[model samples]
Target: MAVIGAAVDSETKQVFDAIARSRSVTTSRLAGALITDFIRAEKGGQVVTTKAPGLPAMGHAAAHAGAKTEQVYVRLEPYYYDELGRLAAQRRWYRSAYLANLLYAHVDRLPVLCHDEVNAVRQVARQLADIGRNVNQIARKVNIDPDRADLSAFDFELVRMLLDVETAAVKDLVHANLRTWGATDVQ
Candidate 1:
């Protein structure tokens, strides 16, 4: 394994660190996956573009709270070093950020959502939560005062069925989103 030392800007390093922390993996491991994916894409003749406008930016606190730059040393096979150099040169991107862009492009398990899609998902989630709360409240009231709660006209089975259907739909939507983002084992 040859050590490839690269200087990454503070923001990019912070972003990588944040993602690594979230995924409970080391930065080096994440970098290795990114490099592997990049190489595979290149070899398959896929145009690997670095642009990801949908990714959320690192928080303001994180952006301002690190060294201006940092050194990342990854131990890779010798051939990867040459390939990385060639690809970075071809793309005219800094070596460290080139790898960072690959990471951004292929975040595992994170569904990349456009701004409008995010808003739409949030709205649906909020509505689902509200419905859940209402159901729980009604159930609590009925349990506390069965006679006064007026369950004579309410169909508990129907409500349960509807909730089940919505739950399945939400799960399907989540699995579809994960699959769309190249994630597997969507359970």
Candidate 2:
């Protein structure tokens, strides 16, 4: 290896020896590599930060064999919003957790809402269904003549009255429940 360390001082040799010991490589091979690097820099003006010791033909794998690398991206939203909502819900804790999933969803997994809010929404829906059922039931009870050419003579105010009653009932129920539970009026 052209008398390795022909140009480097004893301190450089000690550094190379330490590097070899720490890296679990032979001193002679590391010294030979340093000499070859100097020769390459002197002759070809090529400066490389890393020097590789000689490898056998069968051991041609990379120094960092079996290493893996990847790239990823992250997205962020407000962190405190959900936590505040959850704490409010826990503070009240009057409504069931399942109803919260029904706020903006039919079955589940559509959107987020506190349990109190979802129960209020569900109560409104139930009141509407009740009004429809009551209208159908009253119509059946009155025995209106369907054979008539025009049943416009019948009182239409009854239907409006039923809807108003339903609306009032839902309002009273929601306001009372919200007061009872002390749910935060976030949504």
Each candidate structure's TM-score, on Cα atoms with residue i matched to residue i, is 0.40, 0.26
Find the candidate with the highest lDDT and give its number: 1
Put down candidate 1 lDDT per residue, 1-187, tens digits, no spaces: 8555569999999988876554445677656656765887878955322222222233212323353434568887889988888766755666675565455435534454434446667876786788789788889998999888887777778778777876776666667655644555765
Give the C-alpha lDDT of model 2: 0.52
Model 1 TM = 0.40
Candidate 1 Cα errors over 4 Å, as ranges? 1-107, 185-187
Expressed as tens digits, the lDDT of each residue in 1-187 for candidate 2 is 2453356788987876656654445677656655666888889867432424332111112222332423233343557546545655664643333233222133211234456657776877887888778668657755766564354765668768867876776666555545434442422
Clashes by residue pair, model 1 = none
lDDT of 2 at 129: 87
Global lDDT of each model?
0.61, 0.52
